[model samples]
Target: MWRYCSLLAQLVMHLDTFRVSRWLKRWRPPPWPALLLRVAVYSGLWWVITEGSGSGWLGLVLALLIALCAPLNVATWPQQLRWRRLPLFIGFMLKNSLFGALIVAQLALSRRCSANTHTRTYRFRLLKGHPQQLLMANLVNLTPGTLTLRLGCDTLSIHILHYQPQIEAQLMMLESHIAALYGLDHEPWEYEY
Candidate 1:
């Protein structure tokens, strides 16, 4: 029993170390481009919310985190990008945020959701264990009419209610947004419509 306890303690200690390392990377990022991105994110938030003094403290902290620590959960962060992609990525996120808000509003206004509505299920076959993908899955789950279920170590199964061709197209578009934002080096064929 003592042997087992000692092994457990060692494992827990290692996990703690890993978590601290990740936290430091974002919460206290190294100098240069990372700092620039962090500042940009915070300034954008300050503009969007438009509150003064202590009121924006939470937003400031969160913005700093989203800007700095995002790489921990987002695989694409380590990659560098051409400056040209910056505006395009922001536009993509803004659009996604708008769409997400609309989904929430519809769900709130409608007294009932059609239980019989058609849904399409997709299995992301051989999905790797990626913190970034996990973040995306969580975002997907937050939107109404969509759910990311059974997120596993190596796969994801997504469910969408109210199936339509446009939605599929939109998902494809999102793929491009992610690739661009993260500076993923995809071949031309992958990005082709």
Candidate 2:
């Protein structure tokens, strides 16, 4: 719970950190046009996830709620203009979420996806004590079959739902994904420890 709150607080902090009034002196974004673009993206997200889950009105209402949030989402619009991230921003969210869902699902359906198993344990040698390992470990726990038992200073021990050849590879891939997503790999040398 504390972690969740910290993440939310940081996100809200970052969103408000940029001031458009101060920013517009240096760069411009088509405010209404950009707002429309944001609305469209939110609509698309609403369509993708709730498309089949509920009635049309509920989806529309949900999408509108998401649209309502967009203005607050654009705090860095001017800085984005400075960086010219327009093309990248135009791209849709790729459907790679399936891999994560499938991994969680496999852990769920198998009896091993619980907090404990009859005789199950797995140990991981972290490349270093990256904080993301905790998230990775918690994800392992949440997927029904596993739980993170211990996070030693440099190692993680998790009770497995089940073990297989590709699991480590999957975790490694997830680590790289997380690192790239957050640009952790490019952090200044002073942060490496």
Maximum-TM-score candidate = 1
Residues 126-186, candidate 2: write the lDDT tens digits: 3344455665565555433345677766556666555555655655554555444434555
Candidate 2 residue-pair clash tally:
6
Please write out the lDDT profile of model 1 over residues 1-193, one tens digit for every residue.
Answer: 9999999999989988778765755653446767677767676767676754435667767777666655556435543545688798677667776777787577667888553344454433222237546755775664445677666654456677656557655654555555555555354432221
The CA lDDT of each predicted structure is: 0.60, 0.52
Q: Candidate 2 — which residues are off by over 4 angstroms? A: 1-130, 142-146, 186-193
True-vs-predicted CA distance for residue 40, candidate 2, Å: 21
Query: On a 0 to 100 scale, what is the lDDT of residue 122 in model 2?
Result: 43
How much does candidate 1 score in TM-score? 0.47
**TM-score of candidate 2 against the unseen true structure:** 0.33
Q: What is the C-alpha RMSD of each candidate to the true structure, in Å?
A: 10.2, 14.8
Best by lDDT: 1
